[model samples]
Target: MSIDQDLSHVQSLLDPSEVIPPTSPLYGPNAQGWAVQKDLHPRLVAVPTSPESLARLIAHLYKSHLHFGIRGQGFLSASAKDVLVSMTAFDEFHFDPHAEVATVGAGQTWGAVYRKLKEAAPSYAIVGARTPAISVGGTVVTGGLSWLSAEYGCISDPENMLDAQVVKSDGSVVWASTEPDLLWTMRGGGGGFGVATKFLFRVRPYPQAIWAGPILLPRQQLPTVATRLEAFLASNPDPRVSMFLYIIRKNLLETIGAFQDMLVVHAYDANGEEHGREAFKWALDIPGAVDQTGVTDMEGVTKLQQNVDKSKGTMRQYWAPLFLKTLSAATITRAIELVDELAKQDSAVSDCTYLIFELFALCDAKGSCAWPRPPGAKHVILIGAGCPANASAGQEEMARNLAEDASERILGSRTVNLLANGGEEFHDPVMIWGENLDRLRQLKKVYDPNGRFQGPIRA
Candidate 1:
C-alpha cells in the first residue's frame, strides 16, 4: 500500500516486459507521445499488455495517490507524472461480421484497425482517425471525424456503443455504455472520465467501391470554388460525400512557389469516383488546375492524412476549432483571404486548414454530448497550423491569434476547443466547455471523486 514498496506487486502480476523503470534507457521511449502536452517527470511508467494488468496498475496508483496519465498511440501527449501507462500493448482487434461491429483496443491506431477490418470485412468500416498514428481511444473520445462522417456521424458510438471495459478512477474495473450519463461523457467528453482499455464501435457497410481523394484547385479561383462547395452541401445533399478545404501557403500547397503563395486544398470522399467528381463539377470546371484524385481502400482513408507523418519529431503544432452554422460564399471567401493573410505574416506557419465536419446526424440529437454547439449547426471548422520546432515565439503566437480571432467571430465568447496555452495564447476552458464545464465537473465527482484520472478536466 506504500509508494516506496517499489510497486513490486504491479510488476509481479504482469510479464517482466510490461514494467518499465524510469532510470532505464527506454524511459524516454515510453514517455514520449505525438503531442508534447507539457513538461513533467514520470517517476514510474508501465505498459499494460492486458486489461487485468491495467486494472492492477490503477489500484496501485490509487492507493499511492500518484495520479496517472494514459498514453495511447501518443496522440494526446502530456508530461509524464507519478505514473504513466502506455496502452500500446493493449492493441487488440476483433471484428464479428455477424454482429456488424469491431471490438478494437484503445492502443490500436486507425490504420491498424482499418487494415484488420478490411481483411475481415472490406465492405464495412468505422469512423476513425485519418492518420495511422492517432489512437482509436483519442479519436473515439474526441468525436472522431472521418471520410464517411457524413453518413455515420462522429466515429464514436454513443447511441450504438455496445460496451467498454475500463478501469474507473477508484481503481475498480467496470464495463461502461449501459450507464447513460457516463457513456455519454466518455463518448465525446475527451477522456478524463476513466481509463478505457477497450471499446466496442458499430461498424458501417460501404457495399461499393469507395471513391475519394484530394483535388487541388487553382489558387485564383478560391472564391468560385468555395461557392460551389457551400452549395453542394447546403441541402440534404447525399451524405456519402465529405469535404475538407485546406487553404494554405501556395508554397506548401504545391511543391514550388514563394513562401507566401496560397491555394485551396480541397478533398472529397464518395461511394464512387464518378459520383465524387460529379458532385463537385463546378470546382473541376476551373482551368489550369491540378488533379491528384484517386480511389483507395478504406485503410487508405487515414493514410492520406500526410500532415501527421510530416510533423513528426520536433515539429510544433496548434489546433483551434469553431462549429459554424453555415458556409456561405462570403464566409468562404473571407476564410481563404484570412489564411493568405496569416501565412504572409508568419512564414513559419506551414498551412491553415478549414476542417468541416458533417453535422447532419447531430440535428435530431442535442445535449447528447458534452461538447455543445448551436442548433442548425451541421459543420465544424478548425484552423490548424504546424511549424518547425525552431520557429520563433512570435510565429506561433501569430498562428494562435489568427485562429482565435476567427473562432470568436462566430462562437462569441464560446470556443469550440481551447487554444495553445504553453506559448502564451490561452483560451479559458470555460470558453471551450461553457455550461458543460459544470456538468463534467459534477460528473468527475461521481466517477473520479479524487480526480485521479486526470485525462483532460481538472475537476
Candidate 2:
C-alpha cells in the first residue's frame, strides 16, 4: 500500500485528536531536541493519552504496515520517515512516598518529575545529567549517566528500577520487570525493545544542601592541571566531586587564534554543606589558572547544567565516550595534546569542544545493578561538540572527523558508545560492533519483532 493510504488507515483506527497528519503544524515543528537529524516530517503523528490508546495505536499501525518512532519531549538524535509518536499528551506523575518510588509517564520531563516528586515526597532519583529539561524516558533507556552516577549508579541500574509498562511489538501492553532478562536489557539498552509508557524508579532522600559551579582556567596550564587532576582522582576518588574540562576557540576577532583562556571546569557536590565546602576547596587547590565554585540546591544545579536556550534554532551536537581502566598521567597528557590540536581547527567547531571525565566505582549496592562494565574499566571520558543546526554541513563532518581521530590518538584501546555516530563502524579490535549489534538485534526481534519502535537512526 502507498504511504499515505497506510497513514490514513492507521488514523482511522484512532481518535481524531490522537492522530496528526503531515500538514499539521506539530508534524515537523522546530521545537524538537538538539539534533538536526530528528527534524524529518513523518507521514503521520500519534499522541496517545493512555496505555490502552497506545496499545491500540501500535496494533493498528502494525496492521497497516507502517513503522513508528516514539518521542518524549522531542529529545532524540534519530530521524523518522514513517509515523512519529509524541508522548507529550501522556504526561502523568505519581509518587509513592512510603515506597520511595516515583512512577512517571513517558511524556514527563525531568523538571516536571522533580517538582512533582519534591512536592509529593521528600526526594527522588537523580534525574538526567543536571538538566531538568531533558525527557525522563529518553535518558533512562539510554543508560542515563549523571553527576550522581559516581555516587549511586546509572539511572537504569535494576536495584533502583522497580518496573516499566511497555507496549511490545505484538500490540500487547506488558509489565516487563516480571522477566529478568527483559528487565536487564531495558535498563542500559536504548529504546529498541518497546515504547515504555511508565517508569518505576527508587528515589533517594533529598539532599539538605548542594555545592556546584564552574571553574575557568588558562589553556596553557592544562598540562599541569591534568597531572594534578589525575593524582586527585587516584588519591581521593570522591563520588561527591564531578568535573568537566573544556578547550575552546572562537572565530570572533578578539578571541581568534587565542587559546590561553578557554578551559572551564564544572564540579558538583551532593553531600551536605560541610563536605561540599571541603570538596570545593580541594578542587580549587588543583593548581589551575582560575577557579569558581559555590553551593546551591538541586533546582539551581540542574538549571545551570542543562541550560539550552529554546530560542536558538535546532542544535547539532555529537557525544562520544571512552572507558579507561585507569587515568594515568601519560594518558592525561596525550588527551590534552589531542584536544589542543583539534581546538586549532574552525572556530565554530572548536568553540564547542567539551571534555568530561566521570569516575564510577562500585558503591554500596553496586552489584545489584545491570550497567555493563568491562573487567577493569573504572573511568568514562566523554568528548562532545555542539553547533547550530544551520552551520555548514562541511563543518559538521569536520567536527565529527576530528572527534574520532582525537579519540583514537589519545586512547588506543577503549570502548565507546556505538550509537553515538549512528552506530558508525569503528576500527579498534576491542570495539566490536558486530557482537553488540547482533545481541541488540536479537533482543529487538524478541521484544519488537515488527520494529515498531525507532531509535539510534538504524533500527
Model 1: how far is 53 from its true place, Å?
Answer: 0.8
Off by over 4 Å in 2: 28-31, 123-128, 247-260, 286-292, 309-315, 359-371, 375-378, 385-388, 391-393, 414-440, 455-459
Candidate 1 TM-score, C-alpha based: 0.86
Query: What's the alpha carbon RMSD for model 1?
Result: 3.8
- Against the true structure, what is each candidate's TM-score? 0.86, 0.85
Deviation from truth (RMSD, Å), model 2: 3.9
Across residues 78-123, which tens digit of lDDT does each residue of candidate 1 receive?
A: 5456678888777788998888878889887778888888888878
Distance from true location, Cα of 71 in model 2, Å: 1.3
Q: In candidate 1, which residue pairs get closer than 3 Å at backbone N, Cα or C atoms, i.e. clash?
A: 130-302, 250-261, 250-262
- Separate clash counts for every candidate: 3, 0
Q: Any idea what lDDT model 1 has?
A: 0.64
